[model samples]
Target: MNPVLHAAKLGVLRGWIEFKQMLKNPQEFGFNIIMTIVFLVVLYFQRNKTIEGNDMALAMFALPSLLGMLVVFGGFMGAATTLTFEREDGTLLRAKATPNGMVSYLISRIISVTTFSMVSVIMLLMPGLFLIKGLADTSWSGWLLLLLIFIIGILATLPWGAVVGSLVKSTASSFNLTMLPLGALTAISGIFYPITSLPDWLQVIGQIFPVYWLGLGMRAALLPETAVLAEIGESWRYFEMFGVLGIWTIAGFLIVPKILRRMARKESGSTMEKRKQEMMSRGY
Candidate 1:
């Protein structure tokens, strides 16, 4: 079998095992499901509103952005939390001692987290299509567009999870810390609102990150063409989104491995012992 395929398959199998583990401990996934429902419900109520001549504008913007947000959030936070928890518990150290262990472990994490995100999207889509009449106009092409952006956006975000996972020392801290950036990303990403209405500086800041582009792609996927900015001279904005997301994906590929390797190199038995001791001292 091809090496990459072999590795990926192994990763996927490991992911399945991880999914079973997650199912056994349902709090996180449960919370995520509830949050998805809450968000969709909010949008459902707002379905009667109009924006820029489009009814159910908030749903159009929120649903796809929520898809990207949920996936990115799941990939980054899930990996970070799992990696940090394992490190604290010495699981990562044990894995590190195995041949090709680190690669397999990280790839497994990516697969598992990606799987979770896809599942979340699938669960959200049923009501998103049928119950949320706002999305009634969304077509097969929109779904395809969403899938493409999601795959790319998830790829762009997953490696950052690696870096975070390798660097963090505790699952507790990982859970809390990961939310800070993610919450900010969701807020500024134009998930619930239009980026155009944001202050100039914030819009610039939003442009600096992938969240905006992902949100824009999501908007493009779900919103009517007239609802988007498509002036003849400024038509490039839509094309620019793919370019921006692609650049981030490439940069993440190059940067994340180096950071993970460095983090791995910094790991030592003594460091693990110290972490264990610290956790014990904290009574966790």
Candidate 2:
């Protein structure tokens, strides 16, 4: 087998093992459960409420949007946290010492993060179907569109996550960097409400980010055509959604490699030991 292919295969296996181990870990499993429960509770409160000027239940309206947020949150935070923690623990240094190790590491992180995100989506979606209405009314085409948007959404967000992770110095810093901005974006992006309801300026800001576009694309895929009445311009704006997300996807692909390579180049035993000592000094 070609060396790169062999390394990729090993990475896939490693990722699968890590994912399984994560599922088995009580802390990680509980965290996923808690997140799902929180989502369900929010939907429960919105179950009887209907969107303004539309008969659609608020829960139903928010379902796909929540899925979009999950993609961004999962991919972004997952990558950021994993990379920061591993870098601190000298995982990157070890990989640097091995041939093609960076390639393998990158592939494994992608698989692990994507799998974790997808599982979170499924956990939320399954129960949400029973709790909410209208989601099950989609056609096969709608399902296919949802799948495509999901894949694109991951591609659009994951690389930026890597970029943020590479730039941050610690896990806490990574959380602060990703969560604060993401929380602000989620509010403006209308994950729980219609973006059309926000101020024009806020809507413009939201439109520039992947979270909003991802949610809009998911809404386009899952909601009925009449539901567009609640959207800005009363249209799905598929072209705009794809265009913005495509730009992000292109930029991320073009930029993440250089950043990762630079970060990798700086990883050495001395640096790792320094980081380790800092962690110990902080009692981490």
Candidate 3:
């Protein structure tokens, strides 16, 4: 086999093993379970409540949207945080020392992160099917669309995580730059509420980010046709969702390799030691 192909295959195997390890790790499994429970609890409380101007259960409206939000969160923040910590721990430096290691390393990260994100989605979804109504009728096409949106969501957001991870000097800054801002934006992105209810400018602002488009895409996949009544323009807006996410996807692909290369070139034992000292000084 070609060296690159062999490396990629090994990377895939490594990622799967890491993913299994994550499942076995008490802390990791606990975190996922906690998040799943928190979301379910919130949705449970919303079960009887109806959205303004619509009788559909708010939980039903929010469940798939939350799944969508999870995609962007897991893809971007997960990647950024992972990269930042691993960089601090010299994982990237070690990868730089091996033949075709960078490629294998990146592939493993993409696989692990993507699969873990999907596992989270499933963790939420399995219980969600029992907790939320109106989802029971989702057809084969809906499932396909949901799968496609999940894939595109990863493609759209993960590379941006890599970019932010490369640019930020620390995980603290990574969270400040990526997760904090995203959490704020998600408030207006309509994961838990209707976008149409927001001010016109906020609606416009919300639409510009992947979080909103992702929620909209997931809702389109899981909700009934009548649910469109609550959306902007009263349609699925498939074209717009794909168009915006595609732009992000393309831009990230074009930008990340150059950034990663530059960041890799600057990696050295001294730099790694400096980061370790900084992290220790911060009591991390």
Candidate 4:
């Protein structure tokens, strides 16, 4: 097997272990499931009937965007939690002392979070599809497009999660900081409404990140072409979506590894010990 594959296999195993641990925590799992369902319900009901041609089935237009949002939330947040919590607990420090530890650890996290995000998509998504009405018209090609966008979207955002995981100093701080921007992004990214309905400035902001385009791409894949034009613009908007997301993915690849390296440099036994002591003193 290839070195990358071998390393990835180890990472997958590590991630699976962590994922199982997360599932065993009922409060967290319940919150995640409820959050996803609530959002799906809201988005589905709020869907524009005009876009679906007087049908509520038009909710398909929102699925891709919501999937993107949910995936990012789960994967990025899960990773952020893992890294910060591990750092606080000294696991990261211990791992760093092992040969190939850094590689194994990071890869494992990416795999694990990606898996969790994908599972969330299935659990939350399919029910919305069935409840929404006319979405049954989706061709195999449409499904293929959705799957492709999903995979690429996951890869594109995973790097940002790495950057976030590397940057946040602790679990509490990460939680407090993450919610606001992510929530704002959900609203502005056309996940619940048509991007064309947003202000020009907001549309510009949408273009600056992948979420908007990811939503647009999802709409393109699952909704009717005419419906998309009515909601966003022309069908050709997908090419633009492809272009914008592709650019960010490439840029993220360049920046994230450097950030990870710097973060790794800061991971020392003494620092971990000090953090643990601080947490212990604070009754954490």
Candidate 5:
């Protein structure tokens, strides 16, 4: 068998195994539980409220948008932090020692992040079905569309995540690099509110990133047609959503491998040990 193909299979198997193990890990399991509770709590409070122009409960509006954000977050933050930590621990170094190692590593990250995000999505969606009223009516097509968004959203964000991970010096820096920017984008991206409510320039800036498009795609997937009235141009603008996401996806693919190659070249036992020593010095 070909080396890359064999590596692909190995990566897939490893990714699945890691995902299964994640549920058994206390910290990972607790994150899922805490995330579900936090989202549900917020949705519970919003159940009584409605989008300003629409009869849809704010919680109903938010749930899917938050799901979209999770897809992006899982791909971006998930890959970045994982890469940064693994690099510090010498996992990347080990991978770099093998044939087609980066390919396998990238594939595994994609699979792991995709599965983890799906679990998080379901964790929120299951209770959301009971907690939020409007969602009970979601059709099979809506579920399909949601899945499509997840796939696209992952492709759009994960490479960039890997890029960020490769550039950052440490896991702590990865969080600082990813989180603060993500928070700012979330504020303007309108995951909890419609972008139509944002200022004109902010709206343009918001639409430039994958977050807004992912949220828009989710809303299109799950919300009633009438909800478009609250969106810009009063339409779903599926063209723009895919177009923007496609650009990001293409851009990520073009740039990530080069970045990863450089990062991997710089990875060695010494680099890993240096990172460990720095962490020790900081009492981490």
Candidate 6:
């Protein structure tokens, strides 16, 4: 086998092992459960409410949008947090010491992050089917479209997450960097409500980010055609959704490698030790 392929295979195994470990960890497992519960609770409260212009249940409208938000949060925040924590703890330095280690490390991180995100999506979608109405009305084609949008959403966001992780100085800073902006974006991106209800300027700003397009794509998959009436231009605009997400995907792919390479190059034993000492001094 090619050396790189062999390394990637090992990385896959590593990612699987790490994912299992995460499942075993009480805090991590509890976090997943808590998140799923929170989503269900929020949707449950809105189950009886209907959108103003349409008879569709608001919970149904928000369900798919919430899924989009989960994808963005899982992919972006997961990648960013893992990178920052590992970097601080000298995992990057250990990878730097091995042959083809950076490649393996990157592969493993991607696998872990993708799998973790998908698990969260499934957790929300399964129970949500019973708790929320109108979600099961999709055809096979609609389901396929949802799957495609999901893959694209992950690709669009994960690399940028890596970029954010690489730029931040510490784990705390990385969390703040990714989450704060994402929270604000989610508010305006129509995850919880219709974008058409927001101010036009806010709608334009929301459209500029992947979160809005992700939510729109999800809504296009799950909602009835009439739901488009609540969207800008009274159309799903699949073309624009793909166009914006594709731009992010292309830009992230082009940029993440350079940033990762720079970050990896900066990893050394001395630096790791220094960071470790600082972490200890700070009582972290």
- Residues forming the 10-long window of minimal summed lDDT in candidate 4: 49-58
TM-score of each: 0.89, 0.98, 0.97, 0.89, 0.97, 0.97
Q: Least accurate stretch of 10 residues (summed lDDT) in model 3?
A: 128-137
Model 1, span 1-284: residue lDDT tens: 87556766777789789977775677967886798779778878766665553454566556766776777787678778888888877777876777677767777887788778888877777678775554668788987888898888888877777677777768777877788988997787677776666777887787777777777777677766765652112332767788888887898889888887787777789998898889899998
Identify the leading candidate in terms of lDDT: 3
TM-score of candidate 2 on Cα atoms, chains taken together = 0.98
Please list the C-alpha lDDT of all candidates, in the order they appear.
0.75, 0.91, 0.92, 0.73, 0.90, 0.91
lDDT of 2 by residue, 1-284 (tens): 99989889889988889898889988977898998999999999999999988888888889999999999998888988999999988888888788889888999998999888889989998998788877888888988988888889989999999999999889999999999999999999989999888999999999999999899888888888888898999989889989999999999999999999999989988888888888899999
Alpha-carbon lDDT of model 3:
0.92
Off by over 4 Å in 3: none
Which residue pairs come into collision in candidate 1?
none
Model 3 Cα RMSD, 1 decimal? 1.0
Q: Name the weakest run of 10 consecutive residues (lDDT summed) in model 2.
A: 128-137
lDDT of 4 by residue, 149-227 (tens): 7877776777776677778877887776666677888788777666677799997887787777667666667776656
Cα deviation of 244, candidate 3, in Å: 0.6
| Between candidates 3 and 4, the lDDT winner | 3
Error of 5 at 94 (Å): 0.7
Better of 1 and 6 by lDDT: 6
Question: RMSD of candidate 1 to the true fold?
Answer: 2.6
Provide the lDDT at 177 for model 4. Answer: 60
Residue by residue across 1-284, what tens digits does model 3's lDDT show? Answer: 99999889988998898899888998977998999999999999999999999999999989989999999988998889888888888999998998898899899989999999999999998899889876878999999999999999999999999999999999889989986889888999999999998999999999988999999999999999999999998999999999999999999999999999999999999999998888789898
Model 5 scores a C-alpha lDDT of 0.90
RMSD of each: 2.6, 0.9, 1.0, 2.6, 1.1, 1.0
lDDT (tens digit, per residue) of candidate 6 on 47-138:
99988898888898899999999899988999999999999888888898889998899989988888888898899999998887667778
Q: Select the stronger candidate by TM-score from 4 and 6.
A: 6
Count the clashes in each prediction.
0, 0, 0, 0, 0, 0
Least accurate stretch of 10 residues (summed lDDT) in model 5? 130-139
